[model samples]
Target: MSEDLIDEDEGPKKRVLSNSQVLGFVMRLWLRRPVLLAAAVGLMLVAIGFDLALPHAARMLVDAVTAGPANADAAWAAWALFVGVYLAFTVIRNIAFRFWNPLASRNMKELTDEAFKKVQSFSADWHADNFAGATVRKLTRAMWGYDQVSDAVVLWLGPAFLVLFGLSVMMILRWPAVGLFSLLAVTAYVATTLLMNKYYTRPANLKSVALDSRIGGALADAVSSNPTVRAFGAEAREEARIAEVSDAWRAAALKTWTRFMDVGLIQNVLLVILQAGLTGLLLRQWQAGRASPGDVAFAITSFMLMSGYLRNVGENIRMLQRGLDDVEDVANFARQAPQVRDVAGARPFAGELGEIVFDKVTFRYKSADEPIYQDFSLRIRPGERVALVGPTGAGKSTFVKLIQRLYDVQGGRILIDAQDIAHVDQGSLRRAIAVVPQDPALFHRTIAENIGYARPEATLAEIELAARRARAHEFIARLPRGYETLVGERGVKLSGGERQRVAIARAFLADAPILVLDEATSSLDVETERQVQAAMEELMVGRTTIVIAHRLSTIRSADRILVFDDGRIVEEGRHAELVGRGGAYARLHAVTQGAAE
Candidate 1:
């Protein structure tokens, strides 16, 4: 991987999202499954209602018993009502979870799918700029973060708030002083937690999360480059690098967790104050003969309920913070607009004639100080075989990418069969052209799958035919499981020549009107290249072909050869004419005569 590709720049990292933003994002997903969400939420409300009936029932029972043995039946009825309410609450909460669990899981899956789709839609350069492993870590972590967020909202915070509100209302209706104290304590506790978390804990937690992502990226980078590590005997150096990152994460995580404990301690003290104040208020009311024993019992029961609910709320708040931190990465991903976007109402590219035209085009990379191509124009007629001859960093690859509309030109239009590529759907445009890159990377799948990837609907017979046409079937036949053999990651199990042939076979299977050969045979040996070149000659007969020639001698038979330097076409002619003219192409041929031939 290039140094520029691993963009783990921490200084300009993503901003942290607020609770509402995170929850609102989740709620939007829930709205998609309206019935399930409604059922779950409705059940939670019913459960809270049943649970709130208990303290009132306790009050009723105390009053009934205080009226003496004449009220024994009423006392028993109150006790029975309380137990029934308790059981009802338990059942409804369980039912709520049944609905909530599936909804959470489904939404997590959908969120992941949506994030992956957005990442895929990002430009090739955007992908190069980000760490692949870090992106994976964010996607996976955010999925679980959403699960925690959903749990905090539906299971803990929602019920806790409802219980607090209901209990506080009942207290206010019976004992004003106690109710006011309870409300004040809760408000103070929540405020303190929010303030401390925002100022003290959040920075540490965010840093730890960033380092954790770096660790994932580091591991992926090292492991993927294991061959290089072993060749250079840099195992210890790699371990030290990992330890350095891991140690930073450890310190940050410790500080973040300790900050939570600090906040927890303060909230617990406030809880104690709340309990003491309520007890003192109840005693004063009773001593003044202004409150009955039943009222005192209700006060005690409500205090217990409020205390437990408040504690739960405090814990849920902490969980919510952790979830918010984790989800911030993916949320930012959604916020960043894609570098390349299709025009509105873009039509599918309908192609049978492969005539390609670049008319008055101008293009430059964002990082580049100068434009790569300015007002550059060219046209390749249908069934023409055109070869681009140039040193690297010239406009050859960009030319191919432009035709596929990978990056939109700043000015002018690129067209295929007279249809403007920028105005066509990307997938449809790319499907009309087949590209075999210089360094062909394959998925870790069977040879058959690799070849069939170009056309998933291709039959086994069709795959074999394509493979034979590209001279890949001979070596594949010698493999242990033939087409069923799994190529290791990026086809590491195969030689470079083998991978290149497989790529060519895939192009053969594509059956597109246009074909791009980006140094296609550069990986092959002399004998293999001869065989593959023979096959390519047959394949190029009826298609408009663009070859980014690595070996200049190989393109002598092209209908026309273009010599490129910097960003412009310096010379254009047949091979003999250009050689006889003793210009740029002839100079290039003379310089590389031994190696190119």
Candidate 2:
């Protein structure tokens, strides 16, 4: 598997976000849990208040001491009050954080789960066009990113306001020069943090995108080429490819981290400058007799408070950048439009499906520009057994896809029971039809569970009966675990014939009015194919059956045979009549028979 499939190269692009827009997006999810948000906000405010009060308590202790040597009792009383108040605030802050962290984590988990559920509801075409690994990365990032928003709100914004409020109080009560110097230090710290962040944000975001692409590409390629890798004995080669991609990812990550550490270094330097300047100013004021020893102590306390708050502010800025990157990935996923969407006011289909009509229908794969089928038309009557026989790109699969409404026709309409399929709800349409593809895929589950997937609530007896009808029960019973035998991933534990039999059992269990077998029995040997074909004949007794097959012998008994060339049906009739006509069907039948000989 090529690494590019999972993680393609995407260049750095500036994300567009006004402050109001970003805030609005964040608030939308938070507001959904009003009580939790309110509680978090209240706790944050309480924490901030306690933090701000600590600096005031220190100032009070200083003022009491400065009243003169005879005021020793008052100083002792002030010291005791300050210690008690500070301890109470510390306890309160810890308690608030305990309440806040859990609420934030829970909300984030719920929001991500909701997004995943929405993704699952999309149709097959959506999955085909989008990489599964990329989607997983987006969901994971979204959940973890919400925590960054919480940190910014509670740790950064809250502490910043508290520090500013504390500084204001000190300026009023203490020496003016000391207070002025303390404010200047705060300004310098904020300025340096912001400037560093501006340089770091873009690179960090690009690194995230690159990492997502690398992981996604590796996973996609590994899964898509599992058979080839195993067959060619290229496991070592695949491992080397994965290692190369991992190395590229590590390089990108290190670049981002280095930039982030540089920002941290700059922040620390500014903090040192601020603390030293404040300390020097306070000592000068005390020497000049403009401030007492206790007043100088208060100035030191104020500097510590400012430093703690500014450090938190810097941390929050870093967190905010990470949160933005995560949200961008989520936004990219959420903004994806489903390749096929239901029409407005689409209603559920009711009653039996009659003639299915395709009028000038057209379609093409996502990577293809030209339509695979152009101006294609077909009318299949109720209970008609139609075999669509064609060469590999002759639009046989595309025709079946249109009938199931997996992808809407690009040029015209497909009608079921005289009503446009697009107007009916997809669930209802699919419920009336059953499909068994060429290579049947089974989930990693028990034999009974695989058969019961078409009808999850099917009883054990019902499953057994369906299996018997599909000639699969005899083989299933012989297994060590009987019906409970695990099928392994994609039914790799079973032979090709057994897997097709299981798929046939599923179709029998579905009991839908329309049955589609797209090379459904291609895997079976001659003897097994005969038995499975017999079972299919019985199951198709009262259903509209559409079979796509290359083997003419399997489809020879179909009520109507539609022979396709390129993207158009060149001939249509019964087996004997078509063979007698010496047209496309007859010529293909001759070729197949010759190959068999």
Candidate 3:
């Protein structure tokens, strides 16, 4: 995450960003490409200068013809010069557009990359609350919005103003009254544009963008939850829910366009009246011999140019508002802070991980009232095989999470080999531990890719060896595509046992010194479980291991068993010792054993 994106006192709740701030953020990206943008703007102005000069040339031709045979040669020469300049700038305009577009595209790409990296750096809790679809939509729209705004401002709006400025100079030199009216018209148009955009167009555009985000989120939720909808035969209900969001989006779209068009109507009416009234007054001046025929020609041409300028200004203002909304969306995502961060001057873990100690650790979830662990302390010796046995909600999984620094403890500290875990780099600490979860999550990628995920550079032979050790190679070999078969999202295409085997294979490939098995074999049948248990035994050799035991039979050979109740250790001993004592572990073990029988 970049320092500029952070607010020292930022909270989980979103901060309302102002329009100037959002626009300023986007302009920073543009500032990085100053040379390219400046050249483009220069070329654009040259083109506008030509456009402004053409009208004066037309006026000169008109006055020369009115001057009769005396000015015929000068009139023909002026006409020829005008045609040549027009052709020259026609080529220049083409070149400028070609050069400018690529720079805008490059700027957009750079901004997208920065925004994506920022989003990935956010904490897990922030991601959990923010929908993936909405985030994706925001990113997509932000890049596109930058492109649209660049075109509206640099290519059209800026050039239009240049033409107006040049024309105002010519109008004043030719006729004072016309020049005064021209300046007033420009001021009125600008004021009206600013007023309409702020009061009506901008708010409507923001509402529409919010609706688009909601619609996208709803669609993503329904599609990802397809299995749930189909299992209950509620396809129609799901469709209706999506329809509800889509209808709202439609209404928002209608409202935005209606407001924009209504404002546009008033602006066009004002321009028409100004042009008509100005032309009539100029015509009378020409009839009275106070103004030349050329002055009347200049007046008509300038009015037409002003009309075009007004239209482009209105369009750009709307585009500018839409772009601002997109910038706000991406900026909000970038502002979220990662909950777990390395301490100052954090270094990489050194050498081997010999032991782990939870020293007076206290922890609680953000939403929970009571602490899950209150001053909890524990120590695990090097290469010890320990099993944690308890009912659900006993803080087994959370212990693993804290060990991995997925979340930090609220009080005290955890140490590994006498080094505090919080004082080391997060990536280094996580790389030392391997976890095989009960229900492993996989990407929509090939089977081999999933197996080699922990060690991406693993060779085919190494992957096969890991698969064989996990007792997964035989089934994989029989599949149509073997290791190349695509596992649907979350490995849904595979059976429960297959997914477990794949996860185990990934762990085998990882070969980390500290291993965690959270009911790793719970998903398999009795026969498959026995085979996997043998493989797990081999994998655990000479490694510090912690197992969250659901099936008591699997932990019989563990060197130590810690029985938990209500988030505290109730008993600690060998399985045989616990059973003989007839304590909480014994009663729980007996219940599990009887159920299996």
Structural similarity to truth (TM-score) of each candidate: 0.94, 0.89, 0.91
Which of the predicted structures, 1 or 3, would earn the higher TM-score when compared with the native?
A: 1
| Top candidate by lDDT | 1
Q: Give the TM-score of candidate 3.
A: 0.91
Q: Please, what is the whole-model Cα lDDT of each candidate in the order they appear? A: 0.85, 0.77, 0.82
Ranking by TM-score: 1, 3, 2
Q: For candidate 3, what's the RMSD?
A: 3.7
- After TM-score superposition, the amount by which residue 484's alpha carbon in candidate 1 deviates from its true location, in angstroms, is 1.2
Clashes of 2: 4
Clashes of each: 0, 4, 0
Ordered by lDDT, highest first, the candidates read: 1, 3, 2
Among all windows of ten consecutive residues in candidate 1, which has the lowest summed lDDT? 1-10
Q: Please name the candidate that would achieve the greatest TM-score relative to the true structure.
A: 1
CA lDDT of 157 in candidate 3? 78
